[model samples]
Target: MNLLLAAGVLAVSLLGGARQTEAADCPFDEWRTYKNTELRRTADRKAYFWITSRTAIDADGAPKAYHPDDVGKPCGATGAGLDCPSNAGYPNKSWWPTVLASDPTNPSKAFVQPSGPAKGFFVSKTALQDSANGNERDTARYVDASTIPYLVFPRPFFQLVGTGKPGDLGMAFHLETQKQTAFIVADIGPDEPLGESSIALFKALGGNNPNPRNGSGVASGKVLYLVFPRSVDQRPRKWPMTQEGIEQGAETLLDAIGGMSVLQACATLD
Candidate 1:
């Protein structure tokens, strides 16, 4: 029994030493660079860019909604004349519609409702705080869908890189075909799912499915994200950025990332 116990202790010590040696061989600092820029490619040529998502309820505790029909309707039948709805979807209080807002161009339109079943991209109140409209975290007017598309990097990276901040532009490219799209870093995401873009941005890159907000358009390990930190346009940021603008921005971003040559090569093959 004494011999057996001694052997068991030796074996445990050896195993622990092996683990310590392996850990020492791979230091955290060496891998920390991946936290800011990681490009993972699969055998099938699919790529994944890891980043976080920042979609949460506003200070008033309301989820954001995008309503296309809000062009001409009043919010409710009474109260402060605010056009907010009472039953907007998820992250919103069941009794109060805090994230609702009216169309600035046409106030007669009803407040935009939560995207119950439809598919689209709209910045959350948390995201809207960084926009040109200033911080309206408490008001229903924070739910505008016409805002420019953007993404958020981890807060540490955001501070370190000083780019991809709110309103700054970034680009996502498809490696196999070298197809690309442009976007803004307008919102933050959770920690685990590091790399995420809006449904609209994903669609722009040829991702299937209409609703990305509901996790329908994610192409995991397929899109390559190249972010340009602090690349905000000098002119006033346009709402619902034009297709031409998107295309031009993509082209510029591709050139910046040295993907123009790859894009041309792929184009010639097609």
Candidate 2:
């Protein structure tokens, strides 16, 4: 498949947990650069990047300035918002701030995607804070369905605070529309090791997904599994398998995630 088409599909998949933009926004085609100029006050401020495969035209027939934050509550574009539904069901509490960066190329307009989702932003707390609106502008407004076929990386690569390394352990929340329940993947392997303490933490929060092998699970290092509802149906068969297997799977999955160089590979960001 073409690169643009692949991105469009990925964007739609991610929106499954959220909402999709309208039909006019389908077949995403171009990428527009948006600058969170407000983030300039802080030394940490960096440009947020967005890739769009579709475009949207406003009532005026002028291209609309897009910001992905309009989708749901402020979930840290990182992995935090994946489970945002639990926060309040509608307005996600973890959403970050976002805005339509002024397009340097087109002085009269803001940065925009030419083809896919009409708008998307690289999310960063610094950028939102830098803006006078903070996280409210995007989070406050209802998501316009016209924007789809896009990906919202709350935090773009260059914006990560540290080395931009993936979390030692990655945590994600997925909701099966049919089941209407949340499935969380609390990755504890590679850079992030999980042990009895982490398992206990899961139990404490009333959430499941504990390391199956016990303390030895982290000895060699591995990805442990835990599922909500704690039902065998929702769990990964490999989970609770053996310490050695946990280690193997963790390594395998990490390799797929930019080889541990980008962010800790997450089993399910979809």
- Please report the candidate that would top TM-score against the real structure: 1
Query: In model 2, which regions exceed 4 Å deviation?
Result: 1-101, 106-109, 117-169, 173-270
* Lowest lDDT 10-residue stretch of candidate 1: 23-32
Residue 188 lDDT in candidate 1: 48
Candidate 1 lDDT over 1-270, as tens digits, reads: 122232234234433433333322211112134444443222222112332222221112123343333323344332221123322332234422223333445543324333552222222353434245553322332322323334545555555432345655555554333335566565544343345455456555455542432344434324445454444554365333454675566556545434433322222111
TM-score computed on alpha carbons, candidate 2: 0.18
- Supply candidate 1's per-residue lDDT for 177: 32
The local lDDT score (0 to 100) that residue 20 gets in candidate 1 is 30
lDDT of 2 by residue, 1-270 (tens): 222233234333444443333423322112223232111111221111121211111111112322334345444323222122222212232331122333456533333343533334321111211123433223212221111101112234224342122111121111111111111222111211122123222322232332222212112211212111112232234122232343344344334333322211121221
Position 17, candidate 2: lDDT: 42
Give the per-residue Cα lDDT of candidate 1 at 244.
61
